[model samples]
Target: MGTGWLPWSAASLASGAVLLVLAALTLPPTSEVGQVVGTVRREDAAWLMASAAFFLASVALTMGLPAILTLIPAKQQVVGLVGVWIWSIGTIGTSALAAFLILFRATVRVIDISPTDVEQLGQDPVMTLSLLFVFGAFYLGELVVALVLLLASRLPRWIPALLLVHIAAAPVNHLLPEQLQGVQAVVLGGGLMALAVRSTEAWAALRAPATR
Candidate 1:
């Protein structure tokens, strides 16, 4: 890519990273169905809605990340391509879930849905199957992308290491106390931002000799 577009790409990545962290921060704590409904109704609607919005925006901005990051990989171009495809599928799954969350909140606000009904809906076999697919695809895709970056990209090793750590910790974070739930998102965000900064610096260094 040209120098002109480099800055824009980096900025988009950094912004998306920040939004990811913010989305995680705004997410509600998981609890009993009745408590979850009460939480969503009373104090969590705005937060949950805001979280969904941030997640959507983050996903939109980061959609190109796999392509951009893999552009200059040192080797295994085909592997990078495979990683991109997987990442794209995962992104689509995540986007669907986020959209569903918005609709879910809207439904709760407009209708007097019972907690038992909500609980039953959660137990639907179809929904359970879909959740399994979504979570599996998302985590697997992330791991593949991180591995591509680590094995092929020329960036510092620490960047991809951070991402690997983030991916490993994400599920475990959910098991932690509520206060610690978003830590993995923050770590992932930091890694993305670091990658952006390093890329910009490398591009600038390459241009410096030519400009001189």
Candidate 2:
């Protein structure tokens, strides 16, 4: 492989890292000490700025996968379109997460943390739909894409397993309370890292002279 693949993969990995941070930041509620989610009020210009950065980087990272496939050799791109759709699911998932923040906002909105609001927070209709949009697409799409890639002999073994694990974990995590979401966030973060690094592993394996 050319040195250009090095920079290409590096850029992809670097972008994935930044996007992972955004995913974690915006995914779970961050406590002041224990488990307090930060407010998303536009009153604080700083929060707005941070939110912008998080969404942009996350979306860019989601959208960037298509471009990345283009950079790779045609031989490696058999299931790449499906891969792009699969990656776009990240944007959907994180967007759902941002929308889920609205439930927390509603909690903070009331004069009292009413039982209704508390219950509602546990089961937000809007965020539920959002989660369905992303998690569903990603979940089903990953399986299909993985199967296709596998049949086509275009994907590494770890890629499908890693994605399947993440896809399966998503629904269970969404059922958790906002505070309990951090655990899910951590799981998702690790999953993303696993998917991101698979390419590097494949490259390394191929580079060994005995294989060649």
Candidate 3:
């Protein structure tokens, strides 16, 4: 790839990495996992809004990749968590890593909300709708990418079939409520991160195959 494509992907992935960490920080505490109990709703809104803001920014960054990486004129390159091994590990590999971290958090964030709290959330129309729309939608994007990665014939075989299974679950997740949603989020998120770590390393080995 050209110098420009390399930097853009790296920067976008870096920003994405920070967003994931910040997203984690914005997550509701374990104590409030399923409970409506909290110091104040105002604080929660602020955090969610902040995360949303970063999420929007992340989206923009992601969009810029295709153009910036003009060096590689490939369209629909594998964006897999594990499937990136098909391409030598590099910025492409890191993109897979960042993708996983982002998705991982989306899935697990809901476990912190309790069943009773979810019911209470239902009574509060604004929070209920917002909760359903925001979290569910956000997690859906994660699954979308995972699906994109898994199905692309360009993707490596290292990615297990399970990756596709979990990714396909995103839309189905919407059929259920928040309590179950959170569990689904964690499962998908964990899968993404795992794929990132291992794929990147394998890519590295391939790049320097002579060393091995």
Candidate 4:
């Protein structure tokens, strides 16, 4: 099979990493949620725009994963495709929910909605459903991808190992200090970049003419 897809896949994966890093850096800290809301209410669009951009970047990152999986061997392609479909659904759901939240917040700010109303919106059924789909589907999707990669043996052992480790560390990541939480994004980005580099090298080798 031609290796031409590898470079494009690597580039998409690398770009996803970059976008994830940007999302992390731009995202407002949960600890400062009140302050962020206040700032957004005061006609400061920075945080709101940043949040929107970050969520959108996450969508892009999610999309890139499936694209890269296309490089998997034919026999294992079914597994990769299944994982990709699951993840893509979660990605789309999460991104849409996030985008909706951002818009709702902006609307509240502009309309000067009451605290009670805002609180109700926080507990809105749609919001709950969105959160459920986002976290539940997203995590499950990630697990599927990780498991498929581990089983397929398409890439180096270390690549899938790193992915599994990253997934396993999710609980511990939440325990990290607010300021330190973003570090996970950096770590993830580094892992993806490493995968990209490895893919590039392997693709080149595959394309090289056979030695006598």
Across residues 64-84, which tens digit of lDDT does each residue of candidate 1 receive?
364345334656667766765
TM-score (C-alpha, index-matched) for candidate 1: 0.83
lDDT of 4 by residue, 66-133 (tens): 55464466787887788777766766665675577588666866786665665666678987786877
* lDDT, residue 178, model 2: 67
TM-score of 3: 0.39
Q: All models: lDDT?
A: 0.70, 0.52, 0.43, 0.67
Worst 10 residues of 1 by lDDT: 63-72
Q: Model 3 off-target regions past 4 Å?
A: 1-6, 25-28, 31-122, 157-212
Deviation of model 2 at 71, angstroms: 9.6
Candidate 2 vs. true structure, TM-score: 0.54
- Residue 120, model 2: lDDT of 59
Which of the two candidates, 3 or 4, achieves a greater lDDT against the reference? 4
Clashes of 3: 11
- Residue 98 accuracy (lDDT) in model 4: 56
- Residue ranges of candidate 2 with Cα displaced over 4 Å: 1-14, 21-57, 67-79, 86-93, 99-103, 106-115, 121-127, 149-156, 171-212
Predicted candidate 3 versus true structure: per-residue lDDT over 1-212, tens digit per residue: 32334334444544544444454445453443344334224255644544564554355335333322221114544343222322122223333334543443453364564467555644888755644554444444444444564555433543434445555675676566544544543453344344444444434544565666
Cα error of candidate 3 at position 11, Å: 2.8
Model 1 residue pairs with clashes? none
The residue pairs found clashing in candidate 2 are 31-36
For model 2, how does the per-residue alpha-carbon lDDT over 1-212 read when each residue is reduced to its tens digit? 35336435535544755655655555435333222333333233434433454555556556444433433346646666666677567555755555444445554555445445455555878756766777566556556545544555445565555556666766576566666665544454554455456555555665677557
Instruction: Tell me how candidate 3 scores on lDDT.
Output: 0.43
Evaluation by lDDT, superior candidate among 1 and 3:
1
Residue pairs in collision within model 4:
none
Q: After superposition, how far is residue 211 of candidate 4 from its true place, in Å?
A: 12
Better of 1 and 4 by TM-score: 1
